[model samples]
Target: MKKLFLSCLFLLFFAVAQAVPAKSFYFTTSDSVKLYVRIAGEGKPCLFVHGGPGSWPKIYYALGGDVTEQDMTMIYLDQRGSGRSGGDDKTDYSLNRMVKDFEELREHLGYSKWLVMAHSFGGTQATEYAYQHPASINGVILVASTLHLKSSLESYIVEGARILNKPESEFRKEGASVGETLGKVVSQLNEQDLMYKVMYPKKEMFAQMNAVMDTTLNWHFGSKVWDLHEYEQDFTQKSASVKVPVLVVAGKYDYSVGPQHYRLFKFPKATYKTMATGHCPYQEQPEEFGKYVRKFVARLN
Candidate 1:
């Protein structure tokens, strides 16, 4: 019995010592919805907000890992109703609610001030958040993000269609008519449609898009069509109030969000760069992307 007790004690200690830290946790929103968060590394805090108001935070794991290695405590948070977050409340997925969720998470983590790196739709959230809570943020990074929704989206679709080598006659005809009908046409296309084929050439990209689209559509709070008119006034009015350093990253081939939208942000303290890839620059060129981010953060230090 003594030997067995000693053996059990030893095993318990071994298990405790070998256990990987709890790198993730779930927190409740003010509305009582549960949200998931993953955190790693240790140093200056940097949170990576994902694109697609409904997309899971895991999409940034690779990039977060790279950033964390440089002594940055990287955080990836799934928006309400995405990934492991608990809530069937589609009605609670609005942009404002999402921003509240971000603020709550920041407070929960006890981060007095931290850097924010947001991608695509996540950029939209980060921009709005920065506008509202500039004092809480140390810096902001926008990746392939846009502000002028209608015009920028139109340009993105037309350019994307052209790159697919669709017949020029179809292009010329559609280009002229796209402004009025592009949203309808895009809505009709599903995860397996040819539109995605043109936009995402890689097999992995299709898988990623499908996952993101599933979550986005599942928890969409408002009209299927993104209405910038509702938020445009607020966005512009609040954006001018931002006083922190900002970095806007674009990809040359990013026909999805396009480059024109970046110009709309008139931050007095903003730096913009265009990469040689598409919507997802970090995945397309992780090493270069990581280097650029590190250099930017170094400047802040």
Candidate 2:
């Protein structure tokens, strides 16, 4: 009995020793904005750029916690002014500023080159980063991303109409009748409305939606930079210039940044795949999403 108890204690200690905690740190941006960074998992470095010009990094955690099992050193970064990162309402949340933050973060982390994984609006930022510093990127992964913000916003309006059970023509007429700007409509959308009412309506996905909403809505300046950038942006030539290995995972039911629009990207080394869900495919179908992600990164390895 004494021997057995000692053996059990030894095994338990071994198990506890094997568990690794994530490494957390904060890095200050050029403008002195301190951003939160979480380095989890082991193996090759893979930096995750989350969406929402203002969305936090936790949304990706809600989607799929870590890709460690796929042999990746997952770097989850909460962009400046979002999540645990420090930022004020008056801070410069411009697109170029955001891109520079990522570049600086990479250098600060001591990574020569790493795979960039982006989702939703993050895709645009990641693409821009790669375009500006192609040599610093090993590969690019775009999930439900868009090249043109204005066009993508317009697509969502069309999609929102369909989800509302109204004809496309009628929806457009109503928009004109009410004079509702695209930014006005989009800024008001919560995860509950976008996930349950429109896209993934199942009860199973509701919790995931809640997780996303809770974290995303905490960002004090939600969509403020997004709307401003879209109002004065076009990326046709810039997007085409991304010569790095690109993998775009789009959602079939995504109305916001429709899969069709992603198809318009002319990245010379790009490969596209449409997942079987809506805007938040990573959150909706994490298992399959991880599978595709693993395969894509495996090639880079």
Candidate 3:
């Protein structure tokens, strides 16, 4: 009886595993950190690098699901210390180390050239990776990503306050009253509150940010090192060296990166698309987002 029950359990496990199309594995980095990776579909390979210095790739699943339906294989990875990946040393979150993790993952998966897709902070990561290993990247897709951090933050504060119908000076005054910078004051507010007031500013987009906020908030605050420390390298000069096919999708009202900051990159082969959403266009406007991706990938072929 015991043997029969064990056999049935084994069969159930196998069936469930087979039911899911995605194949998941652990890719160990040079520092021995085992990061989680998920691969689905089959065709041209494309990787999705999620935002949030500490965010996991799982949040991209909503968009990944749609991408998989197209003619491309989707790879999702939880950067070291973020998702199912193993990480005891937060110091490993440095830019070089993070880039190394991505490079090693691509080598481990046996892909020579793959399209890189990044959102928010992941945009910085994608650029770093492409700059370092140009031979390994076929194209890049940046969604509301920024190349200049300080400028982006400043724009967010100025434009964000304006959208909220609150003067930037007023926000500065409030922050000063609390002995904090305006940016710090803005950071303290929850995603929904901030999105409703300044970031998205539209009722529809604001409502859609809830799930994204819930997931990212948990990931963002979970880290101590990468979350607080500044990235070691500034790739402003290296950014100009990126000649890969680039597709930038920006949110017209995204307070995070500021729409104007999109001009910072000078990719030789580049295409730009503006959406009527906030930071997470894939979540707020999935259909349009998918269309943009499909068209970009198609043009590359």
Candidate 4:
């Protein structure tokens, strides 16, 4: 009897010793889509929404959150059809559906509320989610986020033209879709190796971002963004209804999502800061980015 009790105690101790404070996993949504979700750090929960309308959370997880994570539990989620997530056969990437994904994740995690922070194109999805479900958010953080897709697309066209020494009008055709023109310009820019000029200040950092990414990701959300008219709406105008304190971090030279975009946001409670880097401020200026984000998150609790 004594030997059995000791054996049982040893097993229990081993299990307790291996326990983790947080988890890394893939959770299936109500629509039967699997999303890559990770829970890290401690304190209040903060959902880190990645941008690209189609990008993943990999780069941010690999480089950022060193300091901000110290203040809050950072929940990194790769949205449906992005990163390590699986896409649905119906191909429903609508605004309402994307917002519902966030809500369902929150429900699955059993959190009544959390802070939602997004970058680049993710501003659109995050803002819409917070607006549709204000009670589920404690605060919002937008890093180099674009609230107006059309204006940001124009910025890309103009900047890509200037870098390659070509006229912006060269890319645009009468009655052609903005998405089509943007694609042609982007293809030419990539061919000339000047695309990094618009996305990063040093140019080399763009390589750093690419290094950690999984090229296999389908990135289905990006190509479909222009097809959805709802995405064209000026998200800044709806910011006032979010009902949560917000932190807006902009990059002065980040033309990927116009540097001046932050000015258009109408958050009733907002804190704004503009950095000297490009679109991915978290990579170009990680320390300052972490500091600004940490301070903003600390104020919330």
Clashes (backbone N, CA, C under 3 Å), per candidate, total: 0, 0, 0, 0
- Highest-TM-score candidate: 4
Candidate 3 Cα deviation (angstroms), residue 19 = 9.3
Task: Give each prediction's root-mean-square deviation over alpha carbons.
Answer: 6.2, 3.9, 7.2, 5.3
Give a tens-digit lDDT track for model 1, residues 1-301: 9999999999999887654353888888788887778887556788778766456656666533244345467788877655666656344656677778888889999999899888876776788888878878988888877665555567656664555444434434444554445544454344335555434445576566555444333343233324434433334345567789888888776766665667678776888887876677776677777787777778885
Ranking by lDDT: 4, 2, 3, 1
lDDT of 1 at 65: 28
Model 2 clashing-pair count: 0
lDDT of 1 at 287: 76
Error of 4 at 81 (Å): 1.0
Residues 121-173, model 3: lDDT tens digits:
78878998999899999999998888766667677677656655665666675
RMSD of 3: 7.2
The candidate with the higher lDDT, 2 or 4, is: 4
In candidate 1, which residue ranges exceed 4 Å CA deviation? Answer: 1-22, 62-71, 163-180, 183-237
Q: Which number leads on lDDT?
A: 4
In TM-score terms, candidate 3 sits at: 0.80
Error in Å for residue 241 of model 2: 1.1
For candidate 2, what is the lDDT? 0.74
Q: Could you tell which candidate, 2 or 3, scores higher by lDDT? A: 2
CA displacement after TM-score superposition, residue 189 of candidate 4 (Å): 1.3
Candidate numbers sorted by TM-score from highest down:
4, 2, 3, 1
Worst 10 residues of 2 by lDDT: 175-184
Per-residue lDDT for 81-141 in model 2, tens only? 7778877777887777888888898899899999998878787778888988999998998
